[model samples]
Target: MTAPRKARSALDLATVVLSLMVGALGIWTILAGPTELLPIHYNAAGQADDWGSRELLGGGLAGLALLTLLLGGGMALAAGRTDDPARRRALRYAQLVVVLSIPLISLLIASASLSGATDISGALPVALMSLVILLIGAFLGRVGPNPFVGVRTPWAYKSRLSWERSNRLAGRLFFVIGLAGLLTAPFAPQPLGLYAIVGAIVLAAVWSGVESWRVWRTDPDRQPF
Candidate 1:
């Protein structure tokens, strides 16, 4: 594990800006918008099924914005603590993902709140999730041992080689599924695309874990348990 240290970078600054944007959007929406209950929750079918006061929606967005700020700032400050260049790079990429998610999530919230219809297709959420997954997959293979990221498993943690191999496989799966999501989310039947995306993620995670365990079991230096 890498030690924690104070470090600052451009991405860290961007995170601050992104977080503020989310907060500002939420506040602005609450102050200048309809007082009717906003769509605060969506069902599996991608339809807004739950409603709440504008305060609920605004507060939730603000909370998420704060979390994003913390994660981004923390990751940036901690980036220099890791001696491994690969891990450092991976951390930065992860921060980027977190930072980017702020805008996408805010957009989803705004869309859901503003929409007058009850049955909105889940395309936007699916697309956003896919985009995030794709971005993460692009750099997942570069992530070294970190409890906070990558494919952490008993076997993966047992061996650096296993971790690398498992993450590489996971990265490919994520990229593939994300690409599939991007392609199908627009036209797929209601909820099917979401289900497919979830299924793909589960399959990838299971496969990666199994691969890690197998790799660990076959290692020449393995110790009997």
Candidate 2:
């Protein structure tokens, strides 16, 4: 595995910036945000904003703000350790996705109340943007010398071909689904849009693993560490 030395590049500074943006947006969202139509939570059952006005763990705007802080802090810290140029670049892209998400999701969720929508019409865009970010993260992890992220299937980590193939598949699936999610956002039902994003990713992950093994089996120079 390639290990990154302790150094902060100009790109690393950007990671700090990203966290700040997320943190700032989170604060703004929590302060001004009404009960969002969709909020990510721990429970699968899904609850409402019961944790008070400023509390994120309780739900609503607080939740996003808290997440922003955590994600921002995480990215900043990670940036300091990473060595690969590709991973660094990918992180930059990740910041853009995260930055775009604040207003897009906040507005979309608030719009649900105005639209009086059970699922709302804006979820497609949300899901799609998120999907793209997810993919970028995967690509960076796979290409970088990180043991913690990316595909990380036993086969993938063990073999160079597997890692490359799996990551490529992942990248393509994420890009396509993201586009599909955006285009399908208005036409498809909310549930369907969500499902499409989820399903496409799952399919890619599975196929990547299977394909990795196949490549290993066929290649004379197979290496599965």
Candidate 1 wrongly placed segments (more than 4 Å): 1-8, 120-125, 219-225
* TM-scores for the candidates: 0.79, 0.58
Measured by TM-score, the strongest candidate is: 1
Compose the digit string of candidate 2's lDDT tens values, residues 1-225.
223333334434543554454456456545565464333321111122322233351234335545544554455456546786666644444443344444345444434333333433245445545555454544432343234345667776567766677667766666666666666666676555565666676787787778767776776676645
Error of 1 at 133 (Å): 2.7
lDDT of each: 0.75, 0.51
Worst 10 residues of 1 by lDDT: 1-10
Task: Give the per-residue Cα lDDT of candidate 1 at 218.
Answer: 83
Off by over 4 Å in 2: 1-10, 25-39, 42-53, 58-142, 223-225
List, residue by residue over 36-89, the lDDT tens digit for candidate 1. 877777766667788887777777778888888887777776777877777677
> Which lDDT value does model 2 have at 84?
65
